[model samples]
Target: MVLIVLGFIIFIAINVVVKNNPVAAKFAGAGRILALVFILLGISTACVKQIDAGEIGVKSLFGSIQNDIMGSGLHFINPLLDVKKLDVKTQNYTMSGVNDEGNKAGDDAIKVLTSDGLEVTIDLTVLYRVVGADAPRLLRETGEDYRDKIVRPITRTKIRDNAVYYQAVDLFGSKRDEFQQRIYKSIEDDF
Candidate 1:
């Protein structure tokens, strides 16, 4: 803003001087040009943003979302509609529980079933992280509820789908590994 004011002053001074001294006015004109250039460059620079590493930004122009994603480093943006950043980084989760066995559980849960059809409660802990790059779409589509809707449903589906394929014996015996792998595959597909 100051630069804009200075540029206007220089331009007026140049025009005034031009009325009497032509040579001095020519030098003043140069100053005016430089000042105006400075003002424009300053405005443009002010509109730019510098996103840090591991950050992603969604840019919108006049309420229209831009398809291109902005990432780490400096970028020039329009003052009218600019960047909104979202951090994308690996995170950690921890869970613990106590079992009837009188032992501290190592973040694991167990769901059981009987010969008759019934829902069994299982104690389990999951330490998971996002290992993909579809976070923007994920967030946009599900907002903050992505975990509950996408993650938990997929997890439950995986468990149900795999569990149905085997009898109760398989869940606790040698077939457990196969059941777990199947569950993992199912979850992966959903994810």
Candidate 2:
């Protein structure tokens, strides 16, 4: 509506200028082009995605997240907002104690006993999906460097700190699964 009104006004101005001064009317065309760009950008930002079956969408307006979650099918929204698609599908990650070399990492799989008697090693795979509303926040806080900023330090800290509480056998032995869970939780919370 706003664009339509502005467009109509610009059209009238262009006609009046064309009738009076063709050169001035030509200059006004440049302003119309700029206005057209703004309108297109606004429309693009207000994009709507038809949610897939069993999926939900998160939306943000001018970077402020909206709580109105989107479910399947057509939805209406302001063009000044952004839409993010999120899969609500069930997913799982299969983990086994293994290193980069493909060998079964020992009980201390992720942690090795240091010369000073500290044991530590960390090997794990993660499965993750972004929360729709928080995607913009996540992007702003970490940008494209999220993995490094959020993942590595939390992981290293958890493994090292947890190792201090357990011996090499506990780190690498039957208790390995427990350790893995602890590390996963730590990183998940911190990240």
Q: How accurate is candidate 2 locally (lDDT)?
A: 0.60
Q: Candidate 2, residues 1-191: lDDT per residue as tens digits?
A: 46645655766676677789866865777766766765665465445457787667667676765667787788867655567666645433322354333222433234445334964555555555556556556655665455556654555566676666566677668877887787678767765
What candidate 1 gets wrong by more than 4 Å, as runs, is 1-52, 61-64, 80-87, 90-120, 123-133
Candidate 2 ranges with C-alpha deviation above 4 Å:
1-47, 53-55, 86-119, 129-152, 184-191
lDDT of candidate 2 at residue 23, scale 0 to 100 = 69
lDDT against true structure, model 1:
0.62
As a whole number from 0 to 100, the lDDT of residue 105 in candidate 1 is 39
Worst 10 residues of 2 by lDDT: 100-109
* lDDT string, candidate 1, 1-191, tens digits: 45666767777777788777877865875877877886786677658789898777777675555667777898887766656666666532212245443123353344545344554544433334543355456555665455567665566556766676777766678887887788777776776
